[model samples]
Target: MTLQTNDSAPHPNQFALLKQRRFAPFFWTQFSGAANDNLFKFSFTVMVTYQLSVSWLPPALAGLVIGALFILPFLLFSATSGQLTDKFPKTRMIRAVKNLEIAIMLVAAYGFFTTNLTVQIPVLLACVFLMGLHSTLFGPVKFAYLPQVLSDAELTGGNGMVEMGTFVAILLGNIVGGLLVTIPEVGHTAVAIGCVALALIGRWLAQAIPELAATDPQLKINWNPFTETWRNLQLAHGNLVVFRSLLGISWMWFFGAVFLSQFPSFAKEVLHGDEQVATLLLVLFSIGIGTGSLLCEVLSRRHVEIGLVPLGAIGMSVFAVDLYFASRGLPVVPVMGLGAFVAQSAHWRVMADLALLSLFAGLYSVPMYALIQLRSQPTHRARIIAANNILNALFMIGSSVIAGALLSSGFSIPQIFLFTGLANAVVAFYIFLLVPEYLLRFVAWLLSHCVYRFKVTGEQHIPISGPAILACNHVSFVDAVLLMAASPRPIVFLMDHRIFQVPVLGWLFRLAKAIPIAPRAEDPAAYDAAFAAAAKVLQDGDLLGIFPEGGITKDGTLQEFKGGIMKILERAPVPVIPMALTNLWGSYFSRIEQGGAMVRPFRRGMLNRVGLNVGTVVSAAEVQPALLRNRVEELLA
Candidate 1:
């Protein structure tokens, strides 16, 4: 995981803090919340749709009510919750929420054990609404809590870990919920006991969490949830980038809702299987999501990079479509356990498809969540997160409507999956194109880490206008990521030919559209082409980044500045801004490292206090490689 400090620089061991009291308790609480919510809601959904079909109300109507019960809280209570989070101690508030969960579980238990559906039904609905309130209140506090407890370096890694935990909790919860309902005598009791136990444990954990004071303590409690929710929405709406990220995240929920809510029907019609098959699909998807979320840390080296979104979308489309083909002409199978299902010949395709779908879903989601956390302001972070949750709920409701319509319109379950996968691809393309910033950031990130360590300051010195050449000391490969993270504008980097040939790193660079240069003696044509591209990029009023040191530092010191940078500058006459990257000498990506290089970033709070120092912007006429090198060296020293 990418370990960072409060200063937005890397630190080691940020991951370990996840296990500490401050975070772990809240983690378990949230985990339990997701699990319990799914367990009761899914069990209730199953009961209404199948077991309770003979009831007075139509099954579809009953099912709709159940779904509405769960979602109503987000629409009604989230605003109140967000206000509470900002006004009180989050840990204490969380403790109360958990306790409230325990009470709700009692109501649920009484309903489950009783024969009175009339009395039980309304109680269950009330529980749902209260749970929503709990979630709403918890929303702002949950997200806002992180930046308070975690240093900046820990944000991405920490967010990734939280997301990983949540997905895992969800998978386990869904599987356990499904499984518990099957046992006649123990089923209801087991669920009730589980909810109570998990809630109590959650409460205990909340208590263990350290205190986090309100961001705006004197802020008046705005009891008018609707108006305040809109106001909070307006605050989030102010940051268009963050708003887009939120929408992207909301889209993921819509996709997930469609996939998850259809499992029973999918298992029955698509796989021609029983309830167990539906459970299996849930398990696979949940496991896949958990795996994918966790993998983001490994894939991103701890930064919240958006390229993973496209990668995830691609995986989703490929596997989902493949799954449809895999299921073609397959025979239906009866209900079976894991082993039986495995033995049942037709289940293989469904399982494979489910697994891949979940995996891709994970890849698509984790970064979006982390990006919100990373990009949102520390104070209003939770409310923004709450807004995300609210949007997610709304999108999910819409997904159900769309999926139901499709299913009713003669679309097979697998066909729906196929369409959704294709739609995912289209949506991904549209979102990326609409917001090129995500793509640009990915490019910057790729250049920073693949090339060398980057340091920036007086980044403001680089005119936020016109064209500029960012000249910096090349200490390691990842200089681009840091610079990109720091730079407000997209930069077209001029890099060496050899650096563009390494395996996975090479693909990332190519994807970023980096201009690779070879010496006149190495590849003269490629060299000429690279410079031409550099000039064009500058002419387009984009920032052009280059390292004057040529390549990685070989002697633990800066090399004599090369003149190719001077050539690029003379062609553009753009302002030249110098920067120094410090404390990244020992990072795994550092060229100074030998074999057995550990490329993964350390957990937050584990790494050294690394920083990027941005120097003054010099005029093109004043640009001197030696002078720039000396200035950068002085900063490093």
Candidate 2:
């Protein structure tokens, strides 16, 4: 079901989703929760550093204890929460969590007002655990709720907005939280009051969330955490793509944990700055992620394009390494405020590297989220998201351990950043090796947008799920790549047998599982095999692409449609979408030369303006070749 998108020709943007009621309430609900989390964490951590400096109660050990207290609940409760969300309506679950947050914050206010460090610390720690529990319970609901709230085409935009909202909130929390608790004039009371107030506001906004039905209403509740967790993991492992995406997402968390865990110390030891400087660094990273997240929608044309994952991974590592270099060998200087810190050129370079690293992190994560939402089975989507959260928690916990180990072994923060950046590259390569789809999509998407000014419209006309036939006007050799880049789903392109035998393109085509076809008179076996494969593709509920014009147009005009589409429809009746490619005839792939032979190839028309327009799907019975030709011609015109 395509949830109505409020975006239209006048809006023409990803942010349009924000104006709609279906997404805005939930967006703020999650945003406030994240802000509260970071504010509380940062405030307490900063306060402890200044107030609790004894050898037995070192700031480092205090941080470790706090981290454990907060993350433990995710490890303990994520699996259970997934089941709960699946069984109960998500809005109800969401409202309940928000109400719980208010109570947790009130207790926190009481502890702060006691004016006793011993009593306040433990109470605050318990508040951290309860907050973690709140986030853990809502994790699945936050992600799994999107597919129901927005259309497939809007998934990337929705995820992007949420990511932007979350990190910006974190940035706000970091700046506000640190100063609130650490400022001598204000003290902890200000923080306590703010947190409770924020929680109340979150609860009030959650009430605006539209009602949503449970995905698995009759799902049996499993009481055992160990057994339930194992089952949930298996459920996530059910799909290879889903599992790999989960690992990628978890690795990102691990990477983020390392940086976040080191933020305060890194600011002090490496940059020689105070709380304000630490807040500045958070600002840089937060703004970077928000920028990258917003760009993902425009870059992928609002599709769950995993190509950005590799692009993000590359930028993350490169910038991380650069950050180490930027931080190294600075002259001894007294700790300074944000203004003095930015005055130094070396420090500015350090900030640039940090900003670039996190910007790519945004690009890296938004798609992984949208992909999980798009790929996971709707009935078990929340459980799958729960599994992701559990893994994410484990990875983060492990990151703290590894970073601590490295730091204990005498590695400086710069060394750790360099090594961590290199580690990101290795892990990303390993994941890409396992699933090349991410990389291939990256290359194709890059080719379409960067190499050419390719534009697309009517992508929403394609069916969001199940089997469908994409019948298009074949214009050039590069048509397949551009189409694949534009499409929402992986398409099995029916290729001419001879082109399938071409050296470089053939190998790539084989990897994409493009079908090889020949005229029945020339090669009956190849012709028969192609049709059989096309039928099986549709039957198994996958997209199949057919050049109903049979071959590339020699005169840049729509060619006569072939009978293959009709035959395929007869075999496996499904929706047939008409697509047309324009502005490619003069390029090397087209037959623009004399005698219908090609001339200069490969970027000869460098940065050419190309257009790929998709049209609404037609019923199988209405997919007559003559009518299909008319539809293609009209779109091209």
Candidate 3:
């Protein structure tokens, strides 16, 4: 099924989505669910660790056991949940899940009311597992529902708001749970009532979510978790980019999990601060992630800019490594409160590092999520996200194991942070090398955002899916890069073969998989090969970009269209979209009055205003070199 566009907002931003019916109710529903999950789990952990005395579940192992129970459902039920999400109406499933949360919280409230420590311990532990199951079931529906409701233009902002909301909810949940459970006389009762109240609030919000048809209503239910899990992985693996993105996102979870799990010990042992300092670290981290998640829409110009992924990776490594330096060699002192910790200048750097590290983590993750939603097959999108969740659970489990081993082998928490930071650089480099699109987009994003003030008009005209020929008036050497920046999907450009011989840019084009061509008279074989490649691109349902003028404009004016576009159309017969790159003339990459391009740097200085105007598509039957040229000229005008 084709993705639906929400035209509720003429121009949509992250916050603007909060007021829209399509987004707001669902946002609060998921937000309340996350808050309640964290609230219940953190409160239970605190109760067991400090108040309750259980022989089987000791203080040291309380967090570990609770966490294990929480993530266990993802491994056992995520595949089944994904299938169910695709099979049922999303609103129905959302309401059902919220109903389940209410039932589970009621059981938890009874467990909290029990005065017997022995009975209460098992009951709450069971509640932890039940809450994990709640999250597992909701995971697929939460992500899959967005693409069904929001337009491609709103996907980034919507995902940003969701991500920001989720982190903020977690922060609030932890704070509320921690505080409510610490009440002197009625701690348990307050937590019990609070859990039930949040669950009811979530259910109420779920009622307001608009009904959405299932993407794969005819899909048969897969009950066997083991086989279905394998099948789910294979489905995700069908698209290598999507699959690798799943892995990238999982790695991010693993990376962040390590820091989050270490914060308590790191605060107490390394920073010489009390429990309040650990809470302080959590607060800073959550705020940073929320700040970064919100910044994504602004930084990406409201597009699914995966370029930020690499930028985020770099910042994560940098700040993480700096955190080790910031905290190492601190003098041992009596455990200090939050106020004292903040008063010390040395601790300020430590706080900043943690905040910045988590901030970059937010940037690294939101695009990957949006990209997965945008690129995955709508029918199988939920399953692919399920695979991502499974991987995340496994990665988080692996992180715990590895961190435990590292600590047992005498590695300090600061040392572990240093090690993770160094390892992050290697992992990011490897992933980017494997998926060069991330690196390519990073370069294009840098040029468009840093080198120029790039704007796109009529971008909604570009087909979100299917084959189309993008015919543009080529003004400079960097036209393809700017176009790539403007486009949500990758565009395979047909360029002059000689441009392939240009130094650094050549390598970049090759990495981007741009096809090169020569004049038939000069090199018939190369010309034929280029057109063959272009046809294959369209045949595979990808965008093929062509500069109808054949090369860059020499005098910064429109040139007569060439017959190359006609040649490609004759083979693929896809719709041709005329585009115009404006205000790139006289820029550093364009041919100047003196002649050669790129000979002088910063000719137009920084943030030079440039734009790509995408005109409406012309049918294959009506496509002609002259017709396409006139369309581009009109756009240029």
Candidate 4:
């Protein structure tokens, strides 16, 4: 289940290296942390529901409180955590956080040992909230660290491994906690011992994570939650692509929260099952999510693949609807235990339904998080991610409220599932339609990966999907086409005004809607029109591909990037995704002299070994025209 050891491959030294300082410790630390969190939460929840003698409220309210305690830190502390992640070394901070968990767990153990409801209740809630706080601080550091330690090619796989580990740990912890609470004589002391042991394991693991400097070590800590939270949200909103990705991710959380929260009620009301069956339902969901999270690495071809989102959505809807019908003929009687529930054929349908839902949930969420990491400005990446967590919390809270209303209105659990599935379909359609970038990225990915034969590096620096200004080293006229083919989104190229009048290429450019710009002194009107078009494309979240050298290189060497890019960015305000066309320098039609033939027919062997290198998005705020031009030059070099 642990993907950490498998990262390198199956070699003699791999196992030895896995236990070495570079990998084992951090891996175990994160694993132990996840395990301990679920263990405490699951045990506390089970105790409240089945063991407590309190008569004031139902068990469902306790479940809600558990959910609330876990989510509260995201609302209040995530912004501060974001700043802290940027300001401190990740491994050091992680070690410190693990120590804090040890302290928290000891207090938790004290409560468990006492078996005092009033004392245990407050202590338990405090532990849950503290764990939430720990997660809040850990979130940004975890994301930011990957890009530093992982190569661009390894990022997707690394992320997949992390997600897989986290969820599996969750499942084990939940199962253990449930079993511990349900056991006849294990008592609170056993629970305390388990938590303390897990905490110690986590501390040992934290010692293994390699040290990496903070993304912005000088970043000031902003302690005020309210103003800083608003600021973080605004920073995320500044990039439309990132903002939309955040929304998609938040929607996924909302979907999950609603479904998970409704499980107990659904098991009891629809499946006519008892508490044990409800526990099994939760276990099935956790396992499914863990499976799906690992599968993302294979499904995405080790990249932030947006194509999986629609696929996940479709699967969710299909399985959800099937679940409704599957429960239709089931007996309206409580199942005695895990054995009887499984021995019956109907329960398998419920298990399948939960698994497929979790699988789809993983597919929908992973890419969005990766996209945000890939596209967000480095200086503010942590803050933007914090903003994402905030939105996720809000959406989940909203989902809970909506589900309660639906249940109160006499809708059966099956009916609510049907409704949620349908609503998800609508929302998915609307978001994709509004911002076609996700769809277009999939298109670009298919074209580059399936249609072309090429190798590339520095591609991570390139903005994969967004309103980007791609300034590549121009060579042949088809330079635009090759770049477009490499790109995963439709690009609006700013090309020579004369090319707009060519026969076949002209019509093709027109059809693809390439933008044509004239030199400002030559045709001011044309120049103005080109700028306007470029701005509109970027604002619409489309890529703007441009040749900043104004024309093909005549000497098989670099030419100065024209200032036209500056004009375009002034209007667009989108990030610039720099690209380099390296081997195309010697291609035919790459005019070698001034005023040479602008139109050259195809030459033999001109397209051999054509390659493109993409770099990351450069924010408009940091890019002056000269600096951007230089940055593009360096990418080519």
| Winner by TM-score | 3
Q: Considering lDDT, which of the candidate structures 2 and 4 is the better prediction for this target?
A: 2
Candidate 3 segments whose C-alpha is farther than 4 A from its true place: 1-9
Question: lDDT-based ranking, best first?
Answer: 3, 2, 4, 1
Q: State the local distance difference test value for candidate 1.
A: 0.73
Instruction: Please report the candidate that would top lDDT against the real structure.
Output: 3
TM-score of candidate 1 against the unseen true structure = 0.74
* Per-residue alpha-carbon lDDT of candidate 1 for residues 1-637, written as tens digits (9 for 90 to 100): 1111123334545457566776777777788787777777766666666565446657777767877777888887777787777777787788888888888888888877776778766776677777766666677677778778765445556666677677777777767777787677677778777777877777776777887777767768778878977987887888787888888888888888878888877767766666776777877887788778767766664545665777777788888788778877776555545566678656677688788777878878877776676667666776787788778888988898899899899898888888888888888778887766676565555445444444444444544446878888876666665677666445678888787777766665665677898888988898888888998888887788898888877645888999887778767777777888887766666654353334555622253455778777677889898888888888788
Q: Could you give me the TM-score of model 2 versus the true structure?
A: 0.92
lDDT of 4 at 368: 71
**Weakest 10 consecutive residues, lDDT, candidate 4?**
1-10
For 1-637, candidate 4 gives per-residue lDDT tens digits of: 0001113232222223344565456556777888999999989888888888656536868888888889899999989988887788878888888898899999888877776677778888888899888778777767766666654334555566667678888878988887777777766667789999998888887876888777788888889999999999989989887898889888888877777888877777777777778878877887777677667666665556766676677777788778788877677774466677788887888789989988888777776777777778777788888898889889999999999899899888888888888888888887777656565454444444543344566544545445677778777666776665455345778899887776666766765667888888999998899889888988877778888888877777777777777877778676776777776654453564544444453442322555677766677777676776677677777
Model 2 ranges with Cα > 4 A deviation: 1-14, 52-56, 116-118, 501-504, 518-525, 553-560, 594-604, 624-627
Ranking by TM-score: 3, 2, 1, 4
- Cα lDDT of model 2 by residue, 1-637, tens digit: 1212223444335677767778888998899999999888878887777765445557767778777888898888899999999899999999999999999999988877776767877888899899889989989999989988887768888899998998999888877887788767666889988899899989989999999999899999997888899999999999889999999999999998888878888999888999788878878888999999999988887778888999999999999999999899987789999889988887889999989999999999999999999999888999999999999999998998899899999999999999999999999999987877787788778878777888888767766567888888888777888888987777888988777765666777777878989999998988988899999998988889889878877788887898888788889988888888888877766777464434555636577888888887788878799999999899989
Stronger candidate by TM-score (2 vs 4): 2
| Runs off by more than 4 Å, candidate 1 | 1-15, 46-54, 58-61, 332-340, 344-349, 443-470, 473-625, 631-637
TM-score of each: 0.74, 0.92, 0.97, 0.73
Q: Which 10 successive residues of model 3 have the least lDDT summed?
A: 1-10
Q: What is the lDDT of residue 506 in candidate 1?
A: 67
